[model samples]
Target: MLLPSRPAPVLALALLLPPLAAAAQTPMTATEFEAYATGKTLTYAQGGTIFGTEQYLPNRRVRWAFTAQECQEGHWYEADSQICFVYESESDPQCWAFWQEGGRLKARFAGDPDGTELTEVEQSKTPLACAGPDVGV
Candidate 1:
């Protein structure tokens, strides 16, 4: 006796399953992730991963060193939290940077004038900073 064959629809779905799953697993948008990052300070957990510091100015301007790991991986607010900026680590001298404007998140690297678009990650409580001055005001 011959065994029954799989349905054509099932076979088609099996072929498309992997790509569909991958699309669903795409990384969270900058906006989505930024919500979790704002109003907080980020620093390197280890000394050598990247080294940098953030200086909080009295005028609400945060001066940062992009070369430093903390600055490169860190996120901060500008203009009294009117805008949020993030420095994502990268292999080249250029790194991923993003900011929020008009209820949207825009991203760019280095000095690129044309920026990429981003989606916001779900909001999450800011992570605690262990190395810097207490931000607990």
Candidate 2:
């Protein structure tokens, strides 16, 4: 005799869940990015190693630094479905596509030869430390 099965319901429930890979693939819009990053400092890691950290300030302004390195002041803007950043040290824009998954941010550099990708390892409300000219009293 044919009987009800749990596998069918489980399969249906699984199908109802959003695809995490696809969600991660879709880049966050500028508004979404700003809402997530503004007033927060985020640390990123690459290949399981600490890469750098950035503090997002008001009006899209930012301060970025490599591990134990001096910070660079920059600003970010949206350009053709990508977020582009310009730093005082480098005029050339560095573009990236950013997304959030599992409440963490991920970034992929545009036109990177090594296919570099960064994952946010930590986030905080504290500001970044920049010890140099134009920083602190």
Candidate 2 deviant stretches above 4 angstroms: 1-24, 133-137
Q: Cα lDDT of all candidates, in order?
A: 0.33, 0.76
Off by more than 4 A, model 1:
1-26, 45-50, 54-63, 66-93, 97-137
lDDT (Cα) of model 2 = 0.76
Query: Model 2: per-residue lDDT, tens digit, 10-117?
Result: 233335546565334898899999999999999987666777899999999989987777788899999988889888887688888898878899886775643456
Best by lDDT: 2
Candidate 1 global CA lDDT score: 0.33
Per-residue lDDT tens digits for candidate 1, residues 33-109, read 44434443333111123222333333323334422223324333433213344434432232334444444333322
Each model's TM-score, in the order given? 0.25, 0.78
Candidate 2, after superposition: displacement of residue 118 in Å? 0.2
Q: After aligning candidate 2 to the native by TM-score, how far in Å is the CA of 50 from where it should be?
A: 0.7
